[model samples]
Target chain A: MNESLRNIWTILKRELTGYFASPVAYVFIVIFLLLNGFFTFMLGGFFELGEASLSRPFFNWHPWLYLFLVPAAGMRLWAEERRVGTLELLLTMPVTAAQAIIGKFLACWAFLALALALTFPVVGSVYYLGHPDGGAIFAGYVGSLLLAGSYLAVTVATSAITRNQVISFILSVVICFFLILAGWEPVTSLMVRWAPAGLVELVTGFSVMPHFASFQRGVIDFRDLLFFASVIVFSLFGTSVILRGLRGA
Target chain B: MIDVENLIKEFGPKRAVNGVSFTIRRGEILGFLGPNGAGKSTTMRMITGFFPPTSGRVRIGGHDIAEEPIAAKKLIGYLPESAPCYSDMTVNGFLRFTAELRGMRGAQIDAAVAKVAGLCFLEGVLHQSVDTLSKGYRHRTCFAQSILHDPEVLVLDEPTDGLDPNQKHEVRQIIKRMGQTKAIIFSTHILEEVEACCSRAIIIDRGTVVANGTPAELKARAETAGSVHLRVRNVAAETLKSKLGSLPVAGRVSLQDNPDGSLSARVFPRDKSTRADLSLSVAQTATQSGWSFDELHTEEGRLDDVFRAITLPDSVKNRE
Candidate 1:
């Protein structure tokens, strides 16, 4: 078990270093921050809302924001390896495919976490302007990070399915878009007209919206945390299966 | 240190590798030879544990690759066919990353990386990013990663494929030197490379081992093996053919018209395994007939002939 963790750490370090070694990491970070700023200040109406809480203005936008950015950050994880033929090099090593999958997923998640943490100035502004609930802000950050992880994990699985990065990116975006739209109020209301109420509830239960909303409400519900954790674990498991299928083929 | 038995790999409806098997002991360099899509790379992938066999087994240093992949993998170092490395990293960083994955730590990773860099002649570009390096350097960097752990078994798929003549020679020398200690298997389309370094060679055709032997043994399978060639300046083509063909030891004779109006006669030995030298018999026949010859030698056969003869028959088979 210790050896397995060490191998995961080794793969994680290499992937994280790979991100920083090129212009992609810096470029992605800049774009993420710029988009976050634009969404929060202009479209999200942070100033128009005139509230100390970041729940409505800040955290609410993450499910949509991560739909594209997280896929962009994670699409190259396995796709580039397959394209460059390094997938053979990586899997033939002493490390197991599961370890490599987890390591790469964590590296991208950590980078997303870093990009999320860089938004501290917005949190500081909330504090400077008024007395904001620190607990709720912390929960919002946690929720946002989990949202990115869920999207990234799905991207990782899609990335493992193809060698072309564009195809992987498009596939991930489509899947994650469904994850968001299934429970988005506008889309769910559209489904409620023809669909049975239980079916509508079942489909909405699959989306990340309500679970992410709980954190925004300053409630650390175990069920909500379970939803996010299961998303990550299930998607990473799918990635492992895809990797094994690639080898077998 | 490497044993493969009845290894079968099927991709959907296609059987890429079918019951292919071979074993390599320590200090033996086994050359894998085949036409394109003849399952050379697929077999190498299985031996390196990249792909599990559909029905057989690969044991590296007595550890079953299917069951104890990490242990078997730890005993083997593989340089994949395309020779891939992370282009985002410096050569030094890439080597270090590979070393760490191989279970090295702290100062050991640095030393192993430096050692392999020197061995693969990558010292000059250790700090340069892999993407900026030329093909030869990038290939060597990947080769360096394979040897960094100094494993007992090494699988290199076309190690000298993209190298220039000089680099090819250097890489061959390295393989020859390393083959004295480690069990090595390398695939190449270059026939001369097999003759240069392989202790033994396997020629697979259509997912089967068509021929397997030492360089000399395989060459002996050629139709030209033990044939004698005699070139004479003043002799008529008919006379030379008749004289050489009449010899008791000669099976058949053919004459070629040289540009200089000289006769070039090739005499086949009646028996390839005969201890008598066909060249000597031809020399004696020349003296008896008063025919002066310019060049006379016995053919030892050629690997190129054997490779083509064994592999080209199935050209009609569909290629992927």
Candidate 2:
């Protein structure tokens, strides 16, 4: 409905404003850029890879980098409202739970996009120094956006469970780490050996790395896009349910 | 108009609101008077559709709160207890966000924000972040947000809790003015506020409506057996005492010595009597005794006594 969209926009606008008004957004962006840049240049050894593309270093460490930074960004999404007692005011308004969830998620995603956009200089540096596939770089950015969105969804759900921001951050990190680890060969092979075949495949498919991997390869498969979209939608739906249950309580 | 029918809210094993029912006609200022933890806030939350009742229903402007919450909530402007607000946003930003959330567009949002700011006296602090404002300013900002929507019904919980005496009076005036057109329900523990602002009151204790009536009606119930205080001058103490002792209306009369040539006597009636009858009888007696009456006043019962009597069990349990 038009009213629902308006409500969601209002929530998103306020949340975005809240982020910019505080130093938290800027601090998170600086840290994200600094850490990602450091890992790409120093640890991953961009020159050692001897590749024109940033795919070897830039796209490789995104999942791990987001494992920490996304939680830091999303921990206060709902936790701060609960801590300050503003959740009651928000819920009492003429808006539905779904609108609030989507609105908050979009706000967090937009902020993450801003942080991602700040890495333009790195993109420029890669282009100036050596020839790279523009399509792959575009796919890499899309994959990073999807990964951030998926992590934000998980963090939003975690934040709804408690008023303590630290606990929300820790819980989100643990969950996201598990999802990331499931996509790696070492974990999937171990799961395949012990677990049922369907369960192992399901777990691996649910992992962020595989879907992200497909995108990083410049392959925009419908299945991989659907996987990320499903995660975002499912987690936001779960957050709405949790919030509704809290209000009922 | 607002109607609540036998509303009940249970938290796990405990009932927060129990079979509470009330209605607010258009343009009625109903006061919810109760001690802390007496289900006032819970009832308000249900009416606002913030929380669903375990059973029963709340209807606002023909919309059921549980079934059609958005429509029901659109009719309500609520100022919750302690005035919770976004501390990081400026007052202007918060109000503007609230206006937009209420579906105000373009210049309409700005005008609504300006109107509420003016009404709540928040213009000076419009640019200040909510965290930087004082408690009074924070409360005003919250009030502004609630009224910005121009809802038909207003529910305010402890709206004047942290305000000073002057601020409380000013807020009361605003509420009084608003009540002229809107159906307003506000909760308070202060009995004097009820006497000053409320047209009708519902007194709850232990999640039950112990009393519901106009202020004078509640006071009258408390004073079913009335008492009077009389001060007599220009008459001997013995003469005044004998005259008081002979009156059939005086159930119990006690005399005290005054520094001036006057006697202070407290008279209790055997039956409930109006203040007019008591004054007339006392005046006739003073004239008959040739004693000039210095002071004659009727004592009205206080709501505090009723509250103490009703909530004694809860108070005892809390203490233990």
Candidate 3:
């Protein structure tokens, strides 16, 4: 491997293992599975709807599910390093700031992917009840992973702004919640009163739901993939900018 | 080699390090001394490329820090103040991580880690978590990481701050041993440390270099450089003070308590006295006066006194 590639891999491997060394990995996986099962079966009315489709009962709940879990996973990423003063030690190494950011974000993304994978039983049950759309289920997993990446990126950037994990978590959730509300019908309709049509469209265009809606029925679009990729790239850039802005602070 | 020129660091309107410059050649151990907030750690941070200087430049082995930070940083092994490490990691794990970051790989990483761990005496705590180690062990663990890649330059900030006496001695020995091939700079408030290991010392006060020279040169800069101390059994301090006061070799005689029920007097030379032979005169006078002498010796001037004068000149001048 290239040296920088090796370094990033080393950091990613350590960070991923670090999550498991603590109870964080098990706790996050168990809670995520439980929440997905409860909300899918009880709230989404899978029985009453009598549909074998997992979209409404399982995959549809990802945005809200990630709203809480992504920030929880990312809150400590930078905040804990700053608070403990290890940020200085880490930065002084041969690694570049961008490399550190990429390495850590990849770790959290991989951990969230692990949590997402553990929900495979949902797909199994949906298949048992009725012949579910296999392509749709796979696409749902893909879209859901992209959604988790966007949330994690935002949380990682927010965590870089402060040294308090609680503050980082709250700041990320508030920012992410605003992003979620941008395309919600009630909020956009209320905004349609005073807002220009073009501006409202642009605002909602950045929302996760509009982009995430395509993969609900196994439809894969380049635009939705671009949106998630842009979110990840923009947020990672913001994280590095915030880190540079606070140098010698 | 480590070269720093006109380094200035500004935090808002306050200048933490103002236009400081110095150089350290290989085989030299430079001791950085100052009072609290004198910018010792700030200077070290800049040297290690942890913090960019507001102005000026640092060049490690001819590579400019700002222009070529990675190249400069690759040559530096730094131990920041408080010895910050990943507390959750075992000593062995942290060492391996640092070694890999320093570009060591495969069997080289393992060999390098073992070399530094053994040199720092961290073999005993290799399996222990960093947070579980005592202050001394934690300090050595950090020291081990800094040397894992065997960088050409080492910057240590208060490496022995909270260690016990034995630990301090051991750390000093390690630094002395390393000084032969590595250009090293370490900061400390402990004056005796300069004497223990440093080949040269720099005293920084209010973000400026007040004095920079060999350790002995700094001690000689003290105003009482050639003073001699005499502990007499039965002579009155007044009599010795008058007699020593009149001697041409002696300038002023001040009495000090020896804590052993003996009257101790310090004799200062008249002028430019660092190289003067005042002890010979004091001993001759003691023999002629028939005063029973318990102890008599010439003082080389205490580094603490010199440190106080250089780093805290305002208070020292006010007291005088």
Candidate 4:
């Protein structure tokens, strides 16, 4: 168990350092912060909600924002290794596949947290202006994190399938978009109208909306947490399988 | 110690390594000599556990590569061809990461990194990013990473492929020193490198082992079908040709006119014969006819000749 933790730490440290050592992480943080702020205030019309709270404005656009920006952060996690022939070196190292996948995913997730943290001004502004439910604000951030983690997990799995960064990014975004849209009321209603009742329920359960909705409402449900955790675990497991197949090949 | 038994690797219909097997004892430097596409890299990859063989098994230090890959890999240090490394990391950072991945911690990691850095002459470039370094320095950094953990078995594929002559010499010297305590398997297309560095060589061609022996043994095999080149002066071409033709050792003698009024004759011997007998016959003829023997030297067969002779298409088909 100690050795496994050490391996995780080693992979995490190397991945985080790789991010900061290059211009990629900084560029991602700056672009994500700028876009999030721009869409929340100017485009999302936070004042129109009229509650002097960022709950609606900030949390409303996070799904769409992560749909694009998260791929940028997560696309190179495994794809670049395959591209540069370093995947062989990494896989042949004395670490379990799960350790490598988790370590890399957590490092990128930490970068996302850093980017979210820089949006503190938005939270601070909401606090400074008027009365708002602090619990809701906290829950909103949790939901965003879970949502980001889920997307990154999927992206990491897709990245492991190919060496081309562009293809990984595009495929991840499309897949995440589908998952997000599948949970939207209009899409689920349409599926319910046309498809069998059981299939509609399954599709709705698979989407990010129902689970994210609980967190958005300032409630941390066990089922919702399990939903996100299971997604992360299952996707990483798939990534490991793909990598093992590559090594076997 | 390393043992590969009946290892086979196939890519679709193309057989990359076919029932290939070999063994390397401790403290021996075995050179894997072959041309391009001769399955040398494929075989090394299998032994290093980067890829599993389609069949058979590899045992490194008594640990089966397939059954106990981590244990086997722990005993081996591998440097793949072209020495690919991360370009973003500094030399020190890369080495440290590699050491950590190999399960070293704290002072052990530091000491291992320092030892390898010094061994590969990477002290000056330790802080510099790998992308900014020259090719020789990059190769050295990769070399340093490979030996950072001091494994008992070392596999280097084309270790000196891109270095200049001076750099090649330096790397060869380092390898020779390291071979004292480790079993080293290095592959290269340069036969001169084998002659200079390897105690034994395994020559492969067309995805199969063609010959395996010491450099001297291979040279001796080539000498059995040797040809001689001679330069004689002041002798009529017909007389010299007839004299060489009459010798028992000379199978086929052909004379050519030289620019300096000397006649050069090439003598093919049916069996392995020393140059003394051919020299004696030419010397006797020159002494009796007042001719001059400018040059009478026995041709020593080289590794290149052996490689060419053994890997020829006709010879390969005949071996089957």
Q: Which of candidates 2 and 3 reaches a greater TM-score?
A: 3
Off by over 4 Å in 2: A192-196, B223-225, B233-242, B254-263, B273-276, B314-320
Per-model TM-score versus the true fold? 0.97, 0.94, 0.96, 0.93
TM-score of chain A of each: 0.98, 0.95, 0.96, 0.96
Model 2 chain A: ten consecutive residues of lowest lDDT: A47-56
**Leading candidate by lDDT:** 1
Which runs of model 3 end up more than 4 angstroms from their true locations?
B236-238, B256-261, B273-275, B313-320
Candidate 4 chain A: minimum summed lDDT over ten consecutive residues — where?
A87-96
Expressed as tens digits, the lDDT of each residue in A61-171 for candidate 2 is: 999999999999999999999999888889888888889989999999999999999999878988988998999999999989999999999999999999999999999
Order candidates by DockQ, high to low: 2, 1, 3, 4
lDDT of 4 by residue, B1-320 (tens): 99989999888898999888899998889999887898999999999988889998999999998898778888888888878788889999999998988988789988998888887788999999998999889888887877888889999988897888887998899889889888999998899999888889999888788899988788766743356677877778888788778777667787889888888887777454544466566556557777677776666678887887877778665786
lDDT of 1 by residue, B1-320 (tens): 99999999999999999999889999999999999999999999999888878889999999999999999999999999999999999999899989989999998997898788888889999999999999999999999999899989999999998999998998899899999999999999999999999999999988889999999999989888888888888887777787788787888888888899888888998885542667888999998989878888888899998998888865543441
* Candidate 2 local Cα displacement, residue B227, angstroms: 1.9
Candidate 3 residue A240 C-alpha distance from true site, Å: 1.0
Clashing pairs in 3: none
The superposed Cα distance between candidate 2 and the true structure at residue B130, in angstroms, equals 0.9
Q: Model 4: clashing residue pairs?
A: none
Candidate 3 lDDT over residue span B1-320, tens digit each: 89999999999999999999999999999999999999999999899887889999999999997888788889999999978888878899888888878888889988988888888788889999888999889888888888888889999999888888988898889889889999999999888999989999999999999999999999988877778888898778789889988888677789976677789898888776523678888889999999899788877888998987776767667988
